[model samples]
Target: MAPVKKHGRRRASVSASELAQMGVCERLVVFEHRYGKRRTVEQQQAIKRGRRAHARFYREGHMDWTRWWRYFIVFLIFGRWLTLCVAKWFQVRKPHHET
Candidate 1:
C-alpha cells in the first residue's frame, strides 16, 4: 500500500455568515466544513431586492440643495419673521410703573 498523505493546517478566515453560524450553533461550522455553504436562490433574490430598495430610497430622498433654492429662501424668511416676533414680544413686555 502507498504511504498515507498528511494534510497541513488550513489558513483561518471567517466570513459574516460563518460568524452568524458560529453564534447559532457550533455544529453548523462542522456542517459547513463538510459541505460548502451556499445561499439559496430565494436568499440571493432577497439580497438583490434589498439592495435595489436601498438604492431607490437613497436616490429619491437625497437632498439637491441647488435645485431646492426656494427652501433656503423660505428658511431665511422664517428666521427674519421669528426675529421680528421676538422683538415685538420684548416691546410689549416693557416694564411700566403706576403711582
Candidate 2:
C-alpha cells in the first residue's frame, strides 16, 4: 500500500473499512484501488433506496424545538396548576378534628 501524502509528508494509515476489505480480499482491494468499483444496476438501485430510507428516518426522528417548546412550556404550567389544585383538594378533604 502506498502512503498518502499529507503536509509534504508520507502518512501510512488504514481506515477500519479498508482493513476490513483487506481482510476479505487484499487482491480485490488492490484491484479496486487501481481501477474502480463496478456495481450492478440492482446494487445501484438498492443504494439509492437505502439513502432515501435513511433520509426519511432522519427527518421523522428530528424534533423542531421552535414549534415544540411552546407546548412543553404549556404542559409544565398546566402540571404545576394541577398539582396545586390536587394539594388544595386533599387539604379540604381532611377532617377538622385531625388538626
Candidate 2 lDDT by residue in tens digits, 1-99? 343455656435765656788899988878876677777999889879988998987776665654588789999999999999999999889687976
Model 1 segments more than 4 A misplaced: 1-22, 26-37, 64-70, 73-99
Error of 2 at 26 (Å): 1.6
Predicted model with the maximum TM-score: 2
Write down the worst ten-residue block by lDDT for model 1. Answer: 1-10
Q: Which stretches of candidate 2 lie over 4 Å from their true place?
A: 1-20, 63-75, 90-99
Question: What's the CA error at residue 51 for candidate 2, in Å?
Answer: 1.2
TM-score versus the correct structure, for each prediction:
0.37, 0.52
Clashing pairs in 1: none
RMSD values for the candidates in order, in angstroms, are 10.4, 5.6
Clashes (N, CA, C under 3 Å) per candidate: 0, 0
**Alpha carbon lDDT of residue 26, candidate 2?**
86
